[model samples]
Target: MTESLRISSIDLAQFSESRDRRPTERIPLTTIIPRAWIGFSQAPWRFVGLTALMLITVTGLSLISKDLQQGEGWWQSALSDVLFVATIPTTLLPIVALLHLADQLLPSIQSTAQNEPVQERQRLRWIFRQTTSLVLLEGVILIGGLNMIRIIGALIARQSGVISTVVLLAGGLVLILWTLSQTLALPLLVHHGHRPLAAMEHSRRLVQNNRLKVLALLGLLIGVNLIGLMGAFIGLLLSIPFSALLLMASCRTQTPWVKDSRRNMLPT
Candidate 1:
């Protein structure tokens, strides 16, 4: 099926919940990266264009914030602080949007077939609801946990420098693991119609059995983004899409919704 038609026809609620709960096979990076590359290759400019737009907005706000901070006025500093805070959402919104787009676009590029039809308006509404709810839920949990860790670290710092350092390191490690475990939550929600908390729970479970592979995938994506950072952030235009595509692809492989007979034939 054509990409647009396939995307439009997807019924998010039709996913097999039983299969979703089952353990996903570990997809080799060898298969994932090339498939992601091909997916991106098929439609580079749209993804790149979206990233470029985000980059511009983020960069512009950051520069404006810096300038405001340097200005000789109290209100200027306050406004700069607001702008600085705005940058976080500015950065996150694009990423969430990109992931939504990648989720829709990737399956067709990968030649996965689904047969359901929904209107464009309905799809947009579904995506918006899912994305917003997931963002709010995930953001609160992660931020709350990190803040608690920070508070604990601060308390420890008063007791002993070395011990505080150790505590902070351990806490950071815990947060990293927690973050990794929820990596698939967005894909789960957008692709499979999972509720926010349910998606997070499922993602945690999925990551638990495949911790090492998930870690490797994260490391690879991080390295790619880091490389992109070195190029004056222009590389993010490509790297961001590549990362999103790979992530969506990995999620699909791990929690496929196809029939039993076709499971073995899926591109892993």
Candidate 2:
């Protein structure tokens, strides 16, 4: 018993040491996002990231229904808005995860045929192709779920006026949960080699202990999400880098599969 206690104490001391040295910062931009995570994690790169943000914004546009009673083309506009909005989550989340996961899984550059420009470019092309397939594979999940959301929303809207506030509230709650689930998955896939859906489970696990921090990150990301709405439509790509920073910072901290990726005092 005494020996066991001593061993436990020693382990605790080492864990404490890791925390001190690890780089877990709240602000993402300050974290040095792994170059591979930001690059290979994506395909057609900027295009997919931009599309993801745009889809999210599309969902946000649903709120415009509040303007329905005030105008001439209100109902018609509302119909279009709802349809487009419903498409958001279905169209983007999985694709975004695709880019994020690929980068995490195959995160490195390779060199073949030294001193040959043609060979280097060919290798680069091959790498991009592989990355693209991964991106597409993950995209299927993203698009499918997003469409499901749209179908449900459409059915609800079909019931027409007097939409139940309770139902709406419940729905909003579910959507928020879904978003949180998506957020958690990225870290697991990137750093831990979890499958895409598996990443979602791990994300939930990571946040089990640090709910407040995860909530805080969610709030911060939401702020960027608002910006993304306007920015994606305006053709601005600022949120990509901002998100990259957040993801890196998140990886360095306590996540579902492991604890304290940063601040290592003892041997991990």
Candidate 3:
């Protein structure tokens, strides 16, 4: 079916629940998030629980940022880096601590079935370690070995003026896309018990034609996150929690197959 028609006729509620019932089909992000919100909203407390977890993690981000602004020397800078690294553990701990709540992220909409929570958690840990272990390992490995490379590159780039600005904008866009592509696998990893690469491939497959749409969503996420940064303490206190509510809301639309199957199953 065509994309436009696919969206136009899609029934989001049925899409969410039925998708999970299928043993082996891909589920779109559009389908998964909305359906969960329906149930989540009915109880509301579930959403509060979900929002609270996100709030704590975002709170950690705000806390470390303060120390980072104070570091000025080699030792002071090193201390700041250590504080920064410490925060990573804080952001993800909520998800790990309350595995049951992760369903908030998983849409009722799923296609094809995959369940390997034990394996998935192990994989999630590994992937987090691989991708993030190095943000700290980043310090140990490349920090001293190529210390001047970053310094020299900055100096050379500074001389390019207008050319640098244009190039930087292009580079920034590319980096954002890459980061989103890499991290897109993350929600799936948590929700589907998917291994890292499998989750990534799955995310790419579902989002293929919808890359622009997905990217727009990513841009919205980033914008909200940036706003959170500016809000800092207040952001942690309210912005992240509020944003999670909005995220749940915005993610609540329906998909096609679920509507079709529901129509078939219901007696007229």
Candidate 4:
């Protein structure tokens, strides 16, 4: 069956109930970081391959953009525009891949300590298409909203510096809050087959009460990546996946929906 039909067949009400039952526990960085290490140990090669793929694709795109920059003609200009548009979607490839990997890894982490049987993996094509759609939808909404804020800020700046500064600051604050609220969106989409908007809304509600904890989690992840940078970037191969696993752990621990889905996947 096609993916659309399969998704349509899922009972969204049950999914909604599962999400609502998500625990309100605070996700400590200490707990999640260790789980991330365990997850990486389970699938080190897969995460490494994903990181390598992202680096290679980005480098290739940078080289292509440099070549395109040298062209000086109407056709070249048009080509550059096309490349710019193409790159937006292409650049999201790694993010989508990481979400797919996280979806696969979360179940193992949950079951491993319990000595429970894990579910068989989903087909790669299904995971790829689902994650790609989720990433694109989220990316468009975020990027479009940020651009609108910037444009409005610029217009206000032309009239009043103080007002424009306030507008920009408010916009930045909104963006950060929006980002924190939607922290569980990808996992919601992967685990429950939720539509993009519904997943985002659920994520917002899930993290609403624990906003500070979410912020700290995000900051900790960023700090870990910065430390990886201190290692001359080679450390990111491990750090990136490490952060991703922590994210999945956070989602799994807080979201009853993910836990329920994993339970259902076990042998009857």
TM-score of each: 0.73, 0.39, 0.48, 0.70
State which candidate has the highest lDDT. 1
Which candidate should be chosen as best, given TM-score against the real structure?
A: 1
- What lDDT score goes with residue 239 in model 1? 83
In model 4, what is the error at residue 155, expressed in angstroms? 6.6
Q: Give the lowest summed-lDDT range of ten residues in model 1.
A: 107-116
Off by over 4 Å in 4: 1-29, 107-124, 147-165, 254-268
lDDT (10s digit) by residue, model 4, range 1-268: 6987778667676788888775664444446666667667767998988887877777777677668778987777677677767665565667666755765665443342333333323344454566667777778878998999899999998999999999989988998888878888876665566777777876887688667777788888899899887886588887787877777767654333444543322211
Candidate 2 lDDT, tens digit per residue, 166-234? 455666676666566556565545455455456666566666645677777777667775887685644
- Expressed as tens digits, the lDDT of each residue in 97-126 for candidate 3 is 333243343344342226577865675566
lDDT of each: 0.75, 0.52, 0.50, 0.70
Query: Of the pair 2 and 3, which is ahead by lDDT?
Result: 2
> Each candidate: how many clashes?
1, 14, 13, 0
Candidate order, TM-score descending? 1, 4, 3, 2
lDDT of 1 at 106: 64
Instruction: Give the lDDT of residue 203 in candidate 2.
Output: 69
lDDT, model 3, position 227: 86
Candidate numbers sorted by lDDT from highest down: 1, 4, 2, 3
